[model samples]
Target: MRNHKYLFLFTIFFFLLGFMNIHFSLFGIVCMTLPIILVLKDRKKTWCQNYCPRASLYTTCGKSKKWSSHKTPRFFIKGNMKWIMLAYFGISLTIILMSTLGVARGVKLPMEYLRFLIVIPLPFDMPQLFDIMNIAPWLTHLSYRFYSMMMTTTFLGLILAMVYKPRTWCTICPIATVSDVILKK
Candidate 1:
């Protein structure tokens, strides 16, 4: 079950679709929700071992046997970093929801600057891309917020994969940590 070659390939396929302007939200939604559902159903970190795309990617590309044989720092895996990251995720989600609702009500917030920071290096502005696809403006706004949140988490995963254990980020991942807690109960 640990070999996730198919999941790794699927992740690459999705990235290509994303580059072609597809939304690909269903995959993200599934990734976010399935771990919790599995934990509730079977009380295990099944997703991390057999299903997470990022974990698959790390296993395939992170050269963990060669580059990360050292024990991960205790703090990186079992310290305050996880809580801090979870707090950031919670706050970011709250702000994104509030900002999206504000857009629906024709209210403007200074969220654009923050959104811009989040979207850097992407070839197109998210709302405008959605506009081109004839999607509802409110949906566009929500999509941008979701993308921002995903990118933030991905960046953290990349950093963890580079410096610590290939799957170290999984230890502090909000979804994984939450699932672990729920499964323990």
Candidate 2:
């Protein structure tokens, strides 16, 4: 707790900022990218160990013997699940990019249909929020889709943390996995 207190505070600040405006949602990008940056700086897994808001919160909640019931499943810790998750993310990103570009090119795509797959809706309509802020509609749509993706990933991570080890999801996190891979090269 002592080691992670500052990260916990920053996480709260980021969450509040996210609710206040769509632009602040770029914090998600920073969170996703930081692992890789740390790896490049030769501080591999620093974000997961010391800085990730979600990981820190999970540790506080589940680190105690009473809270953590089961050992993380072998498959989750040592099997192909991480690659599967990464592939899912890849497919989702491809769909989002294609859908956004389709909209930009005046080709109608059913974006609402994709949104239905998101486990949780964002707190606000990001496109509408951007409109109120006088930002471009296309960029708003892109950001909205990205935020939806982030929400889905966060929800999945929460479920995994509750069911398994505190940092079970971190083991298979795309960013963390990629960072480790890159740093091993």
Candidate 3:
């Protein structure tokens, strides 16, 4: 734990880079997919336990009792929270794919702003850090969607960390839930 807890900083770095260059948000794809792939290969939650940057962040914070330490309510833990997250994730993925496909088909879908929870668009738009004139519009759109999803989860995790034990979000994280569901069979 001591050796690897700092890996959490990658989560912070990811957001920083993503905000600077939305293309960096593509890295979220690795994060979102790697856990499930690792779990499938190892038949375990190896990503959550030893390598998840978000989990490392939680662990780092847990070293101090600075957080509320309240146990997650059974309402969230007994089953529903994970499912809700999974549904949210699934719906977001659907929107991302469908919209990107629409753009690719030459539909004039305006680039959407930073959406929280896949619905709440923030007032600010992502700035173009570098010239993207050569980049395909659909690719840009895809990056935006990926960034939003990653940000949404990070915000949720931070809120959960503050309100309960730092690792509370992990208990119901979509990746963790998906792993659980797959492993059950």
Instruction: Return the lDDT, model 3, position 182.
Output: 87
| lDDT values, one for every candidate | 0.66, 0.66, 0.82
lDDT of 3 by residue, 73-115 (tens): 8867896878988898899999999999999999757475788
lDDT winner, 1 or 3: 3
lDDT of 3 at 171: 82
C-alpha lDDT of residue 137 in model 3: 81
Model 3 TM-score on a 0 to 1 scale? 0.91
The number of the candidate with the highest lDDT is: 3
Query: Candidate 2: global Cα-lDDT?
Result: 0.66
Model 3: CA > 4 A from native: 1-3, 62-67
lDDT of 1: 0.66
Q: Hey, what RMSD does candidate 2 come out at?
A: 3.6
For residue 180, what is the lDDT in candidate 3?
A: 93
User: Tens digit of lDDT per residue, candidate 1, span 154-177?
Assistant: 766766677766777777889977
Residue 172 displacement in candidate 2 (angstroms) = 0.9
Prediction RMSDs, each to the true structure: 3.6, 3.6, 2.0
